[model samples]
Target: MAQTIVCINNAGMIMQFWIEWVNDDGTQGWTQANSGDYPVDQRRSLDMDALNSQGESIPPGRLVRPHVQAVAGASIAGDRYITYTPGSGTAIYDVTGTSFNYSVTLIQS
Candidate 1:
């Protein structure tokens, strides 16, 4: 069972997004899916297994946070902390906003 994070950007602007793992020791780390900024209407799929920190995978039943921001040098526009158990399935997050009032929607499947 593979876990994945799917981000759909409909914010009408270029946006940057990533997933951070909440380590057992309260440390935060990101994955390779944080490549760069994403254009409007773009959809990105990030495999949770891509997370690697000191040769460690995301522990089961851990918390994974998703972050999204405008690429135009602005602060984080939207974010959500989700408690995810590895091997569960796919988690889909939709980014939608207008005038910096951004919001993230978690679509359960």
Candidate 2:
């Protein structure tokens, strides 16, 4: 399929990117990195390709069920309830449970 490509920003500058991972036990986690240091584009392209390949098996732009925990004592790391969700238009996150800290990274499909 020919996808309509658009530039989110024309100017090239250092940006922060969050990389998420899923463990063997089905738990999710993420870490933050500076785009200036790594090839963020490569990672984003891979992630987007994985999502797009999902096709219609799952609803696009919907949060993956069973939100997982962040790193140990994520609150101390300044991240709480770390989760991944897909959406477009205006980005928004519905945070719940303050008992745990959260650092959410939304990926649009």
Listed per candidate, the RMSD to the true structure in angstroms reads: 3.4, 10.9
lDDT of each: 0.65, 0.28
Q: Which candidate is the best by lDDT?
A: 1
Off by over 4 Å in 1: 32-35, 53-57, 73-80
Give the per-residue lDDT of model 2 (tens digit) for 1-109: 1121111211122222333445546664443221222211222112322444644232233233222222222321212222233332322222223224433333232
Candidates' TM-scores? 0.71, 0.22
- Give the per-residue lDDT digits (tens) of candidate 1, residues 36-70: 67786888776665554434466656677667767
Worst 10-residue lDDT window, candidate 1: 72-81
Residue 5 lDDT in candidate 2: 14
Candidate 1: residue 8 lDDT (0-100): 83
Q: In terms of TM-score, how similar is model 2 to the real structure?
A: 0.22
Give Cα distance to truth, residue 3, candidate 1, Å.
1.2
Deviation (Å) of 9 in candidate 1: 0.5
Candidate 2 regions off by >4 Å? Answer: 1-17, 24-34, 37-78, 88-109
